[model samples]
Target: MYIPELYKNENQEDIQNFIHQNGFAILVNQTDGKLWATHIPLVLDVNADGKQVLVGHISKLNPQGESFKADDSVLAIFSGAHSYISSSWYDHENVPTWNYLAVHVYGNVKIYTHEQAVNSLKKLVDKYEANSENPVRVEKLSEKTMREARGIIAFEIEITSIEAQKNYPKTEMIKTIKISFPN
Candidate 1:
């Protein structure tokens, strides 16, 4: 991640908020000399000891389930709303660019047990069902579904480092705007 100093954001709260808002992330790791990626929704969790962790699951059938190992480095990427910023939007001449918010979480992967996998699924259900008119509780899941869910591989990532950026050349942008519109 080549982050320019002007675009880097080191605010922990902001990073956490962004991750919560956009929980769906891309988990990447290397396996068999190849880079493998999995798209999954991870819940940001704080343990009793105040340690941060990311919890998610992947299908047992997926090779990534076998690829991930304890303490192996992983990268989870969360991308927020983004749009093309046309150069024409500026009064001054500039190149067209894209503006977006992105957070990169680097961590060590730890696989969870069957019981923990079920709990992780329940927690996800509880989170998303909070605002629904008729929330579908995980407890109501059928025995068959629960059985199948147990076949999934649950994992946690203990975040080691996090880097975030809101893509905008702030200083240059402000100066360019002033030049474009002198009032």
Candidate 2:
């Protein structure tokens, strides 16, 4: 994605925080020379090597799940608050524009085994259920449900590069004030 220098944001902490806040992400990849995308929730963690990792799963029946393989290039997108900006809001006339923030994470895909998938699912549940009065842990799942989960295709992405951008009106535009004097 093209990002102007003015809007470019490269803070590692900010990127990580955004991912955690918006765990649901869009996964984009190429399959059979065609573009494919999947929407899923991801669990973010840091490995011993201090590298960031993303884990998620897709239905085994999803064709895109089969298309992804280890070492393949992939992109995970996390979008933040966004809204339309009207030109009328500016002190001077200007074209309407959209103000928003987005982070693009590029990585190499790694398909995880059944056991790893189960662990990842538990981590996801733990993260989301942490605030509940009675947290529902993955271990509490019924045997039948666990069996069904085995049919899922779990994967991890080792983030190689990340690009974040925040788009908004220039400070001058937002601060501009109109003052009139009687002629």
Candidate 3:
């Protein structure tokens, strides 16, 4: 991700918070020299050793599932809120601009078997929605539905590294805001 100095997020906590707040993200992967992305809700996680991970599932019949190889890397893009800022908002005369926050997580996606995928989904659900008063209610499928649901694929991205940004530019008067990933 190309980030300007004023927009770089160097704080680990802020990056994690942004991901948690925006669970729905664009899961990006590459295959056959093609870039593929799926919009899905992701559950953010941290292991006992404090490594960042994400869990999500995709349709089994989808091209992404069919083409995913064991060695492919994936990216989860979590885009946060932004608002248009008129130069009038600034202390000095300047063109209108905007303010926003975004985070990109890159890692290798380890694909799981149907059973493993389902279990991962369960864990993801419990973790992401743990704080919600009204969390998403995953339907309990019947034997047949379970079998069909199993057809769906799931994967986990162990975040090997990260580069993130929090969008607050440095104006003439206001200093730039700094944020870091894995905060």
Candidate 4:
């Protein structure tokens, strides 16, 4: 994520909100000399030590699951609204660009224990099902249904760094034109 100073967003509140709003993210890592990516729902969580972490699960059968080692680094990318801005829309000559909001989280992986995984799943379900007419609670699920949790790998990423970028053409043009067309 190349974040020019002008477009870089360092506000923790904004970044956290973006991740929460766009919980479904692309998790990327390398496994066995090859790159693998999985689109999964990741929720922001605070670890016991009070550090922010991203929590999610993937099928145990997914090869990417094997890539989750304590020392291994992974990237979670959350993307928001984006659109192409034609140069013709600008008042001055300019190249076409895209306006978008994105956050890149880099962290080390931590595979959760069965108990921890279950708790994570419960939190995830509770978060998303809050507004449903008939909300589904993980605790209310039958044993048979809960057993299915065994088939998944739940983990958390201990956030090492976060890079957020918000690129709007109008905002960028103000900075650009100031430098390009000085009075």
Q: What is the C-alpha local distance difference test score of each model?
A: 0.83, 0.81, 0.73, 0.86
Q: Kindly give the number of clashing pairs for every candidate.
A: 0, 0, 12, 0
lDDT of 3 by residue, 79-102 (tens): 877767665555666786666777
- TM-score-superior candidate, 1 or 3: 1
Candidate 2 structure quality by residue, lDDT tens digits, 32-150: 67888889998788754787899898999887777785237889998887777767778787897777788898998888888888988899999999999999999998998889887
Candidate 1 per-residue lDDT, tens place, 79-176, comes to: 98776777876757889877678999999888888888888899999999999999998899899878988679898898999989874654544333
Clashing pairs in 2: none
Query: Which residue runs does candidate 4 get wrong by more than 4 Å?
Result: 169-183
Highest lDDT against the true fold, candidate: 4
Q: How far out, in Å, is residue 109 in model 1?
A: 0.8
Q: Which runs of model 3 end up more than 4 angstroms from their true locations?
A: 47-50, 127-141, 169-183
Ten contiguous residues minimizing lDDT sum, candidate 2: 174-183
Q: Pairs clashing in candidate 4?
A: none
Cα lDDT of model 1 overall? 0.83
TM-score of 1: 0.87
Please give each candidate's TM-score: 0.87, 0.89, 0.78, 0.91
